[model samples]
Target: MADASPKHDVFQAIADPTRRQLLKLLVDKEMAVTVISGHFPMSRTAVSKHLRILSDAGLVRERKVGRETRYSLQPEPLLELKRWLSYYERFWENKLNVLKHLVEIDSETGTDRTGPNRLKDDQTPD
Candidate 1:
């Protein structure tokens, strides 16, 4: 995986729910392609293609041991994704703060969130 940026095709690769599930499966343990394929309904070739994209993304480490190739998760790229998600979390926090002001909560939790009123307040009036 020479491409260092995770935004382009690699993000597209993980946008598919199936591909995301495959990554989760590899998280806990290294698995063989055959074993990984068995978890999904797709054909071996389709699974292989997904694996290739993941490898390109620097997400999976593919190793050849004699007759079979095994794959393990390389979590560094996922750290990038996590960092990206944290930014969204900050956005959510800001939105929550704005709502906090709108609602006039004196004892606020420092977020737009407050009790059951939150659900009704967030609704669009239209």
Candidate 2:
């Protein structure tokens, strides 16, 4: 059976490079699809598809003004992604701190944890 979950979650929506770029473009100001399509080499329809995915993910909002449709970034959904990544960031920070402590210990003991070094352990007396 196919997955019943949404195919266009914020994580999946931002996974595409094109969609990420589109978000970056929308960050500064709201813009019409025509203006956005001009920034990319692909046809407007292709850009629209990406926008649709972004919309599905709740990462983009649309407004109709006169005859034109304007798109803007909706950043609230990204807080979920940010919270998820922040956990990994703490994990990595702890790992890096442990690595730093190990390196400091190695440096103080004059021992190379990275195997034999030519100038130290591997040097031969001439």
Candidate 3:
């Protein structure tokens, strides 16, 4: 039987900026490597390497079309990433809520609850 697990980690595959852009390019349509490479400053071989990593991570789907290969986004794998990030949503919400409360207090009392060192909107760090 074939292994169900991906050869590469989704996080690792997307860690590189180039690979992330590759995913974005393929999001709307399938593309040949030559076409995809045109969007980057790198050589076609470098872009192909990035695509291979994405393919290993199951973030992209590849197929043969006549004499060329085509690639497209396979977003099902990203649900794992989404579910992992969702767990931290509550932490951010709590922090934002505390900041909101502090801002409200600052407005009422005419004081800076954010911190003593925070620069005002009109001020810049020097």
Candidate 4:
């Protein structure tokens, strides 16, 4: 089962595409806003919004160096996403295995029933 946790600021942070890209950028190495913004076609302000989300999620951190604020990746929160995805991995694997077995059986029998096994007219809906 998934962790039935309360609302986490981090979870929503990664849900956005822009924020995900920002996180990916930081994953490589620490960089200033100027450097990070260079990778995107959008304005620096837009990139800044993405960085803000990452910061709130604890996925990135900014440090003050002179007049610059350098951003670095924070990996601890990402482990949560990994764990959540891992839970579904087993469930999907089981479901896919069942499907594969059914497909293999159909192939061996020279029968192909890709949709409902029984015709809709053959049975009444429950």
What stretches of model 3 exceed 4 Å from their correct place?
Answer: 114-126
Poorest 10 consecutive residues by lDDT, candidate 3: 117-126
Instruction: Report lDDT (CA) for all predictions.
Output: 0.79, 0.88, 0.88, 0.80
What residue runs in model 2 are displaced by over 4 Å at the alpha carbon?
Answer: 1-7, 102-126
How close is every model to the real structure, measured as TM-score?
A: 0.69, 0.74, 0.82, 0.71
lDDT of 1 by residue, 1-89 (tens): 47456433556768988889989999999999999999999999999988888887888889998889899988777777787898789
Over 1-126, each residue of candidate 2 has an lDDT whose tens digit, in order, gives 986554589999999999999999999899999999999999999999999999989899999999998999999999999999997898689767766766677789887766754234333223
**After aligning candidate 3 to the native by TM-score, how far in Å is the CA of 117 from where it should be?**
11
Q: How accurate is candidate 4 locally (lDDT)?
A: 0.80
- By TM-score, how accurate is candidate 1? 0.69
> Considering summed lDDT, which 10 consecutive residues are worst modelled in model 4?
117-126
List model 3 lDDT by residue over 10-112, tens digit each: 9999999999989988989999998999999999999999999999999999999999999999999899999999999998897677667666766888986
lDDT of 4 by residue, 5-108 (tens): 43347779888887888888788889999999999999999988888878877888899889988999998988888888998899779767766766677779
Residue 97 displacement (Å), model 4? 1.0
Candidate 2 Cα lDDT to native: 0.88
lDDT of 4 at 45: 92
- Provide the clash count, candidate 4: 0
Find the candidate with the highest TM-score and give its number. 3
